[model samples]
Target: MKQAFDHLKAKGKPDCTTLTDHLDHVVAATVKAATAFGMNVDVARQGAILHDIGKAHPVFQHRLKDSYKHSPTDEPMRHELASLLFLPVFDKSLWPVMVEMVVAHHKSTRNDTKRKGIIDLDERFGPRAFALHSAEWGSWSPTALAILSAYGIQARPISLTEAREAYDYAFDYCKNTPDGYSEWKGLLMAGDHFASALVHRTYNQTRRLFNVPLLTYYNRQHPLYPLSYIAADSERPHTLVTACTGAGKTDYLLRRCRGRVFYTLPFQASINSMYERLKHDMGKDNPDLDIRVLHAASRLTVEKNKYEEKTIQGHMGSAVKVLTPHQLASVVFGTRGYEATLMDLRGCDVILDEIHTYTNVTRSIVLKIVEMLKLIGCRIHIGTATMSSVLTNRIRALLGPDTVHEVALTDEQLDQFDRHGVHKISSYDDAQERIAQAVADGQKVLVVANRVETAQQRFQALQIAHPNVPMLLLHSRFKRGERGRLEQQLTGKRLDATGRPIYEFNTGQGACIVVSTQVVEVSLDISFDLMITDTAPLDALIQRFGRVNRKRTPETIGKVKPVFVIAPPETEGEAKPYELAVLEASFNALPDGDVLRERNVQALIDQVFPDVDNILIDKDAIYVNGRWRIEKLVHKPKSVLFDALDIDSMVCVTEADQQAYEQAGYEERMAYEIPVRYHAIAHNGLARSEGGNKPFIVPDKAYDPVLGLQMSLALPAFYNSFF
Candidate 1:
C-alpha cells in the first residue's frame, strides 16, 4: 500500500500516465485558471487534487484499458462517487463546495446523458450504492490517502459507515440543490480540459492564461479612414459603429473594447482569414498572446505550436477569439457547457463584427445575442456596413443610447470609399466582355455566383475562356486541406526583403481569376480589380461589391474600378436562397454605370428591407426578459439553432480517400472532409465510415481538385448522404 503511486493510472490508451502525475497537472492548471477568473483558488486546488483519487480503486484501475468501455456493466462503478467518500479529508464546512467542483466535472449530478452521475447511481442502487463503491475501499483506502498526502492533502482512514455518510451528504447536495450552474464545476471542467489536452505542457500554458492584449497596433490611422480618427476612449459602456467597407471598422471595434475581445464574423470562410490577420497584426504587441478561433474546422487550423496550441481553441482564457456567431449561439439555446461559456464571457468585451440576419429567424437570434451579452455584463462593440434603420434602430434600442457610443462616417468621409462603378447586366453571358477586358488589361477578376453548381459551372466556363490565366475556384464544398491552400494563395502575405507586403492580390498583380460563391463577400482580405456577380439581396450586394477594389489606403481612396452585376433570377427556383422581391429591390436601388455612392448605402439597404422589425422568434431563444430561462448547471435537452441557421451539417470524402480516412489520426481527419449539407448528398448511395465522425464516401468523379463539390456529379451518382 505504501507503493501507492507505483502502477496506478489515471487514463488509458497511449499515454497511461500515473494518477499522481495527472493530479499534479490538474492542481497546477485549475489553481492558475481559478485565480485568473476570481474563483476560490484554495477550493479549486484541493478539488482538483482529489477529483480523480477514486481511480486508485481496483475497479477503475482495471477499466483503464483501451477496450474497457465494452466491458460488462454489472457493477457500473462511478469514480466520482468513490471520490466523495474522502470528504472527511477536507474541513467539514468546505465539503459541499468541494463536492460541487469534482462530483460533476465529467457528468451532471442529475439528468446526465448516460445516467452515470453519482446521484444517478445512488438512485438506482438505493441503500446498496455505498456498498458497490466501498466493497473494496478497505484494500485501496491507504493507497489513495498516501497519494493525496504527497500533495499535502492528508486524510485519516474512514470506516465504512463514515464513508457511507460522506456519500449521503454528496447525494443530498446533488439531489436538493436549486436550479443554477456551479462555478466550481466550470473551473474543474476548464482546468481538466487544458490539463488533459496539453498534459505536461499545462504548466507553461497556464502561466499565460487569461491575458489581455494591448491593441496598440490599431492606433495607426490615416486621415481617409474616418472611424480610425474618431476617439475610442469614451465613458460609455457600449459602442456601435456604422461605416463603409475598408473604413477601419475592425480597428475601431478593437479600440473601443476595454477587456479581452471575442470577435465574431458572419461566415466561416472569413473566420480563418480574420484569425490569421489578428495573430499577425497584434502578435508584436502581445508577444505571447493566446489567440483562438472557434469553428467546425478548428481541428485543421494551422498553428504555430501545432497540437498544443490547437488544444485550447474554444475553452476559456484566450486573449482574442475569432469565430462565427453560431459557435456562441449555443449559449442562448442552453447547449452543453453553457455555464462555462457564460462564465468566460462575463464582463469581457465582445465584438459583433457582422451578422447575416437576413431572415426573421436569424434576426431575432442575433438581437437576442446582443441582449444576452449585455445582461451578462459584456462590453459589447458592434461594427456593420450601412445597415437599414430598422435593424440599426433595433440595436440602438437594445443597448440604450445612454450607454452606447455611436459613430458614423460623414458624407465626405463615406465618399472617399467610393471605389466601384456599378454596371447592370442580364446574366453570366452578358458579363463576358468585362471579364475578358479585365484579364486582357492585366487585371484580376472575381466572379461570384449564388450557388455551388453555379460557381462550379462558371469556373468551368472561365477555365475554357482563359486557358493560360492563373485561376482558382472556391466555395463552401471544398475539402478543408484544399481550402486552406487555396485561401493562402488568394490572400496570403509574402513580404519582400524590404518588409513590404508584396503578394498577388494585395500588390495589384494581374492576369488571374477566382470564381467563388458568397464566401467572398466579407473578411476575405482580398482586393480584385473587377467583379462580375449574380445580384443578391441589397445588403449582400454591398458586401460582394466590397471584395472588388478593397485596397483603401490614402493613395487608393476614391479610385473607382469596374463591377458588373447580373440581373437577379426571375423565378423562385432560380432564387432558391433569397426572396425575389428583395433581390429585385436590391437590383433596382443600384446605380447603373455610376460610382456606388457610399453615403447612400444605408438608403439602398432600407429600400430592400423596408421592415426589418417584422422578424421575431424570441420564444425559441433561452435568454428572455434579461434572464437565462434555463437553470445553471444543467443544459437544455436539445437546441433549436441547427435548423434555423443555414450551416453545413455533414462532411464527405472522395471514394479514393476513404481508406486513408480510416487510417488517419484525429488531427488529420478533418483535412479529408469536404463539408456538405446532409440533404445535398443524402440521395446518393454512399458508404459511411466506421468510426464516430461517420464521413460519407462520395464517388471520386463527384469531386474535382480544381472545381469543389459538383452536385451534378455527386448526387444522381451516389445518393445516400443522410444526417
Candidate 2:
C-alpha cells in the first residue's frame, strides 16, 4: 500500500492540522452547538462530517502541498462545492438540510456569488468529468470510508444520479422554507466556526450557570444604597431604568439578569473601565466565571500575558460579556460574522447602558437592534439617566406597550441627587479669572470643551497663567496608554502589592485643574468641586453635570457646587457633532437660579429631545427611516452598515518610525497612536506609508503629548482648512 499523508489543513503550514482531526473536533462542536438550541444531534453530526469530505480529494492534497495553486485551465476546487459529490450516499430524506450544511459552509445561500456555471451538476459530474476527477476519487476513497465508519453510517457506492437528486432536494427546500432554511444554515456555520477555532477540545456544556443570587452577592460588599433592593422587587426580564449617577444602576442592571449577561456601553474607554470593575467585583466570588471583554484591541490587552496565549478567539459561552454597542450593531448591519453573534445573543439578557450618548446614526441602529432582539426573544434592558418622553414612547412603540418593566426614581428620590448649579457665561475671556481663583482656593475644578482644539487651547492658557497648579489634559486624541494612566490618576486609585484598591481622593490640600473633552460623560467615578463647560445638548449637559457632587448626601443635595456654561458656538457648523437646534434649545431652557435641580434636568431633556424627527438632518434620516426600514432591515450593503462611525478614520502611525510601529505589538503601538480625520490628512499633506497596510500619518513632530495633533505644524499654509 502507498503511504498516505493521513492529515491536512485547508490552508496554513503543512503540519498544523490533519483532515481527520479537523472533522472529529468540528463534529463534536457542531453537536454541542445544535443541541443547545434543541436541534437534532444526528443531523448536526452528519452535516459536520460531510462538510469537509471533499478536502480529501487528491487534487486538493496536491493543491495543499503547493499551498493551493490554481491555473486558468483547471476548474476551481472549492471543498464546499466538492463535498456535494458524496451527498448521494446520505439518506435521501435528510438531503435537504444536510446538503445545505455541507455546501454552504464557507458561503451564504442567499448571497451565493459563485453560482453561474459552477453549481451546475451535469457540467461538474458528466461522464468525462468522472474520468477527469479519478485522482480526487482515489484520495477521497479511504478518508470517506473512515468518515463513514467513524459516523456509523452504512457504506454505499456514491453515483451521479444520487448527487442530482440531492441537488433537487436542496433547491426545493430553499424555495419552500427560506427563513427556516437560513436558520439551519446559520446554526451550522456558527458551530463549524466555533469548533474550528477551538484549540484544545470541543465545546463544554457541563459548565455551571450563574446561579448566585445578585442581592446576596451585593450584600457581601455593602454598597451605600443598594439599587438591588428596588430591582429584586420583581422577576421580570425586560426593564427600563432611569436613575441619576451614583445610584447603583450597574447593580440594578445585574440584579435583573436571570441568565448570561451582555452589558454594552457607548464608548470604548467606558467599556474598558466597566470590564475592569466587573472583573474585580464578580471575579472575587465566581473565580471560574467566563467574563470576556470584546472590543477592537481587546486581544492585544490579554495577549501580553504569557498564560493566555490561546484565548484570543472569543467564546460565546462566556457567562458575562462587557462590550460596546458596536458589537451588537453587527446584527443590524448584517456583517459576515453575524450568525455567531445571533446564536450567542438569542435569549440572552442585554443591558444597554447610557443609550443617550450615541450619535443619531448609532441611536437609530440600536433601536433596530432592539426590534430584532425582541423578535429573536432576547430580553432587552435599557438604562439611561436622560431619556425624553418622545424617545421613550418610540421605544415603547417598537417593543410593544406593557411589555417592558419601566422603573424610575420618584421626584423626591431625584431631588436628593441634585448637585450642580448652572451659571451661563456672557464674557468668554473674563471667565479665566474665575477658574484661576477656584484653583487657588484648594478646589478641584473641571473644564469641558466642545472640541479637542478648544480644550488644548484652554489647557495651555490655564498652564501659562497658573503654572504652579497641578493640571491634567485629557481627550480621545491621546495615546491609549497615556489616556488609561490619566483616567487612573483622575479616579484617584490604583492596585497595591496584594491587588487591593488604594484610595486617593483629593484631600483639599493642593489645588488641581482637569481640562478634558466629552469623554468624561459616562462612567468615570470622580466628583469635582466646580465645572466650566460649553453649551451642549441637554442630555449631554446632564451627563456632564453628574460628574460634580456625584457622591452627595441628602444634606448636601442643594449645597454641592456650581457649573459655568460658556456661550454657544458662533455658527451651526461650529457645533459639528451636536445638533445646533438642540444646543440652542438647551441653552434657552436652563433654569435662571444658580441652584440646578435634578428633577428640572429631566424636564429640560424632554424639552430639547422631545422629538428627534424635527431635528434629524438629511443624513440622519437616511439611516433611521430610509435605509433601515423594516422591509430593508436585512439588506446587506456592499460594506458594513456601521462603517459610518469609523469611516475615514484610520489607525495612523508617524512616518519617522514606520519600522518600529510594525515591529511593536498591538498594545505597544497603540501607546503612540493618534486618531487623525481623513479631511485633516487630505489638507495637511500627510502621505500613507508604502511599507505595509498601516494608515496615512503625518510626521512625528506634528503630534504633541500636551496639545495633541497640531495641524499648523503639518500644514502651516493650509491651516485654515480645519477651522
Candidate 3:
C-alpha cells in the first residue's frame, strides 16, 4: 500500500494537502485559540491532530476524486467516527473530551430524522473496520501509530476487541457530560474553522488593550465631563447609568471596560454611525485599538474605512466590536458560529446601550442575552436615557442587586440639560403655518414618522409645498448607498482631497428639513430646531425627543425646544411597528406643557412601562426554560435555532439595478439593494426568487428615487419575463 501524506479534503480538485502539514497547522492554531481564553492547550493539540485521521482510509481517498462526486462510497465511510477509533490509545481521563471534540465537530450529537443519538460505535465503526484494513487505508495499525506519534502520545497498538471496549468507554463519558462543561469543544470548532478559512495558517492578532488608562484617556478627551471619573471610582462589575442624551454616556461606558469590548445598539443605522464615531474617537489618540464593527455587512464597513484589505472575521479577534444586540442573540439562540462567539465573549465587557429601544420579542431576547453574558462572566454595562423603574429592578434582580453600580446625573445637572417641550397636534399638515415659519426663518426642521410609507408621504408634501427649502428624505427603504450619503450630509461631514473631513458647506446656511422614520431615534448626532413626529411608545418618543436640541451647550441649557407629537393613526395596522396600546398610553401621559424635566420623563416612562414582566413574554421564565434546553451535557436537538427578532425581510433589487449588483463588489452591491417585508410584497405576485435563495427581484417601476419602495406599483411584463 502506498502511504506518504494524504488529505481528506480536495474541494473542487484532487487531494493535495499532506496529512502531516494539515495536522501541524491546525494544532498550532488550536493551541493559540484555546490558550487565549485560558482553556486546556494539550487537549486541543490531541484533538486537532487526530481530527482528520479518518481521511487516511482508502474509501475516503476515492471519495475525494472527481469521478466519485455523485457516487456513493462503500459503508457510511464517516471519517469523524474513524478518528474516534484511536480512543483506546489515549488515557481514559482525556477520552470523553477528545471524542466529543472530534466526533461532534461537523454534526450535532443527535440524528434528527430517526430521533436517536447517532454517535454509536456498532453503527459507525464495527461494520467498517475490516474493509478499512483490507483496502490498505493505511492498515489502521500504521495510521493510528502515525497520528499518535505526531501528537507525541506514547501508546501501544490495540486489537479490535480493545478498540470496541475503548469506544464504549469514550461514548459513555461523552453521553454523561454536558456540551458546555468546558470551552474545549468550542475551541476545537473555532480553530478548525479559522484554519480552514486561510490558505496557510497564520497567528491571528487580537486587539490590544488601550495603551493609556481608560479613565485617563477619556478624561483628557473631555475635560469638562466627569462621567469617566465617576465610572473609574465605581466598584461593581455591572454598571447602570441614567444620563441625559449627549451627556458623554458612550465615553463613560467605554471607561468602565476593563478588557475586550462588545458595544451594542438597537438599530443597524445607529450601530453603523457609532462604529465610525468610535473608530475615529478611539484611534485618533491611540492607533492600536483593534476596534471592529460586527454586523451582516461588517466586511463592507471595514472596507469603507480603508483600514485593511480583508474583512475582520469574529474568530480572528478584535479589541472592540460595535454591533447590534442581534449579534449577541446568536449566542443565546445557539445559532451557527455561536461557538466562536461564546469563546470571544467569555470574560469580555459588553455594553448594552439604549436597553429600552428593543420591544416585544426582541426585548425578551436582549434580556436573555444579558443573563447569558452574566453567566459567561462578561462585565455588563448598561447606559440609557430612558428606562423605567420596573425594568431597572428586573435587571438588578437578574444580576444581583449588590453586583450593580448605579450612576446618574444629579438633580441639578438634569435640570440644566432639560431641553424639549412637547405639543399635542392633530396632524402635521394642520400645523404647516408653524413649520413654514420655522423653515422661512432658516431653522432645521426634522419630521419623523413611524412607518416608511408615512415618511414618504410627508417628504412629498413638504417638498411640494416648500420647493425652495433644502429638503432631504431619509428612511430604511432607500438603497444603502443613498441612505449613507443622506446620513453623511445630515452629519455635515464630506471628505476633501486629503481624505480629511470637511463640512459640506453648501447646506450650512440654508433652512433645511429632513424627513425620516424611526431610524433617526438613536446614535445620529444632529440637532434640529424643531421636530414633528407621530405618537410612539413612551421610551421611543423619549429617544425621538432627544434628537431635537440634542447637543446641550451652556447657552442652550433650560431653553425649551418645540416637538409636535401628532395623534396615533386611525388603524392599528397603520401604526405597523409599535403597539397601538402603548402609543395611546404615551399620548395620554404627555405632560400638559411642552417643557419636560428629566425626573418627570423618568416618571412618564415608569407609568407607561408599569411592570417589566408584561413588556413582552415573561423573559425570566422563557429564558430559564430556553437555557435549560440549550445548556446540556450533549447539545439538545436544534439548540442553535433562535431568532432575536422575527422581521421577515428579503434583500431586493430592481431589474434595472441587477447589472450594477453583478458588477460591483459585495459592499458596493449592498448600496443598490433594498430590504422589503415578506408580507408586504407576497400578495402583489410581482416578486420572484433570486437564485441561491437570495432576496427576490422586483420590477424597476415599483421603486422611486424620492418615494422609495411602493409595493402597490404593478410590474411591467418585460421585467417579469427575465425572472
Candidate 4:
C-alpha cells in the first residue's frame, strides 16, 4: 500500500507530495477514529486505504500541482469517475458501498451534486484521459502492474470520444434543468464522500473500535440531581423546564430520555455549540452509536458503505440526534424531496431549548405541529430559563396537561441562589457609554441586538464612536466562512501570519467588541466583561444576561458578571390586550415592597406567565377567538398565514414570484409576513383596524432575504394601494 502511494506521489510535483502526505494522514486518522468508535476493524482498515485512490487521476494531479486553474468552462476533477473505474475490478458485493462513496467523495454529505448529466466528467477528469490511460496502463512496468494486481484490480482504458460525448450530455442536462440537477448533485456528493472514507479504512492499520461497556460505565456527575426523580416519575409526555442559565440541562435531559434522543434549538449558532457538547457527552456512553448533527450547516457525510452505512443507520436508528429547528421543520414540511431519515424522528425523545423565543403566531403554528408529533408518541421536553404561564399552558394544551411539568426557581430563591449576581442597566445610552469605557480600558465587550440589521447598525455606530477600538460584527446573514473566520479571530488563542493576535482592539491584549444578534445566546464559552442589549421578553433577557461575566476572572470577586438591560420600547395608543395583561399581572406579582430588583423580575414572570394550566385555561379561548377572527378578516390564504407565521405549511407562490424570489434570495424574508398580533398592531394597525386600507406601504428595500418585510407598519398604505 505504501509503495503504491509512493509511486503516485513520485509522478506528481514536489508540492503534490504534501497533498499526498496529508491525504494519507487523513485516511489513517479516519481508520483510527472509526476503530476507536467500535466500527468493524477490517472494514474500517480497507476503506481508509482506497478512499483517495481516485485523486491519483491526471485531472486531480494537475490541480494539486497548481498546473491547472479552474474556470467556468474548465474540466473539473472527477474523483468519482476514477473510483467507479477501479471499484468493479474488486469484489462486486462491495460495489454498492464503493459506488456511493466514489460519487460522494467530492460532494456534500446531502448528495447535492451526483446526477449523470449534471457534472461534466471530461471537464472533471480531463476529456478522455481515463481511456487514454487504459492503453498506457497496459504498457506500464511490471512493478506498477504488480501493485495494481495486489488490490485484485486491473486498469481499464477509455476513448476520448466517449469522454467527450458523456461530458456534453451531462453539461447540457445541467444547463436545461438546473434545479433538478442542483438538488441531485447535493445528494450524490454527500453519499460519495461518506463511501470514500469507508473505502480508505481497507488498507490502514490504525482504526479504533468503540467499547460500549466502558463508555456506558463512565458516569460524570451532573448538577440537576434533585429533579431526576421528578422527571422520571411524571406521567407527562412533555416538561416545561425553567432552570437558571448554566444549569446542566443537557445532561439532565439525556439521562431522562428513553430510546432515541433529539436535542433541538432555534438558532444555528446555538446548534453548532450544542453539537460539540453532545458529541463529547454521548461519546462517553456509546462510542459506537451514531451521534449525528443535522442542520443546514451540519457536517454529516452521506457516502455509502455496506458495513459503515448500516452501522451509521443503526447508530441513527437508536442513537442521539442534535439539530436546529430548520432541519426538523424540513423533514416534517419540505415537499421538494423526500428525507427518508425524518421517519427516524418518530418515537424519539426531543428536548427543545429556548422555547420562549418563538413569537405568538409562530408559537401557535409550532404548537399544532407538536400536537401532531405527540400523536406519534414523541416525548418532548421544553427547556428555558424564562417561560410565561401563558406559554406553558399553550404547550400543555398541545401535548397534554398531565405531560407538562415545570422546574422553576422563585425570585427570592434565585436571588438568594446567585446573590443578585447579574446587574441590570436601565438604558441603552448608559450601557453604550459604559461599554465604550470598558473597551478603552482593554476589556472585552459583547453588544447584542434583537435583529440582524440592528446588530449591523450598532456595530457600525460603535466603530464610528470609537475609531481606535477594534470591533467585530457577527450575524446569520454573513456567509459561513466569514462567520467562522471572525469567530476564530475573536476567540482563538493563536496568532495570525503577521505575528500579532488575530483580533486586536483598543484594549490591547484584552480589548475587543463583538456586535451580534441573538446568536450569542447559550452554549458559547466566550466571556465578556460587560454586555449591552435590547430588552426582550424576560426569558430572552435572562438568556442574554447569562452570556455576561459567565466565567470567573482572576480579579473578579465571584463567577458572576454585571448585566445591563436596555429599557423596553415605549408603547403608544391602545395596547394589545395580552401586553396589557402581562404588564398588569407583572406589576401585581411584584414582591410587596421592592419595585426594581431581581426578585421582582422573577416574581413578575411567575405572576404573568405562571404555570401551564393557568395560562391555557385563562388565555387559550381568547387567543383562539382572536386568531380565527383575524384570519377571516384578512381573507389571506391559509398557506399565506402559515408562510407568514414561519410555520411548516405547504404554500406555493406563482412561478414568476417564486423565480424572482429565488433569484433575489427573498425566500428567507417570507417568515416576517406571518402575522403576529402585537406586530400587526404596532406596525400595520391591521389587528385593530377593520375598515379600509390603511396608508401602509412596505418598502422594496426593507424586505429581508430570510424574514420577509415587516409589513405591519405599512398595512394602512398597503390596504389603500392593493386591497
| Clashes within 3 Å, all models in order | 13, 1, 7, 83
Alpha-carbon TM-score of each model against the true structure: 0.93, 0.84, 0.87, 0.50
Whose TM-score is greatest here? 1
Candidate 2, position 469, lDDT? 86
C-alpha local distance difference test of each model: 0.80, 0.66, 0.70, 0.47
Compose the digit string of candidate 2's lDDT tens values, residues 39-100: 78898888888888777676766777745567766755566656666667777787767765
lDDT of 3 by residue, 196-246 (tens): 544343343322312222333565444335464573556789999998787
State the lDDT of candidate 1 residue by residue for 1-723, as single tens digits. Answer: 324585999887767777877888888888888887888888889999878898888988888866656646567778877888898889999998888877777776766767777766767877777887777878999888888788788668888888888888988887777655677777887788778877888888887778888998998888767777888999998988888788889999998887899999877778888998899999888988889888888867756357767878877788899987777787677666666677788889999875643455666677888988888789999888957787878888999979999899889888888899999998789888778888899998989999999998888888898999888888889998888767766775544669676566434466888898888788778888899998888888888888888876778876899889999887988986788887888899999999999888888888778777454456656667765565444555443667656454889888778878888877677889888888877777667888537987777878888887777677534543432
Candidate 2: the clashing residue pairs are 8-19
In the order shown, the candidates' Cα RMSDs to the true structure are 3.3, 5.2, 4.2, 15.2
Cand. 1 TM to true fold? 0.93
lDDT top scorer: 1
Model 3 scores worst on lDDT over the 10 consecutive residues at: 206-215
Q: For candidate 4, what is the TM-score? A: 0.50
lDDT of 3: 0.70
TM-score-based ranking: 1, 3, 2, 4
Q: Residue-wise lDDT of candidate 4 within 410-526, one digit each (tens)?
A: 554344324124434455666766786787787878888866656766776887888876677866544333344454454543366786765453224767777887777765656
Residue 426 displacement in candidate 2 (angstroms): 3.5
- Per-residue error at 404 for model 2, in Å? 1.6
Model 2, residue 387: C-alpha shift (Å): 0.2
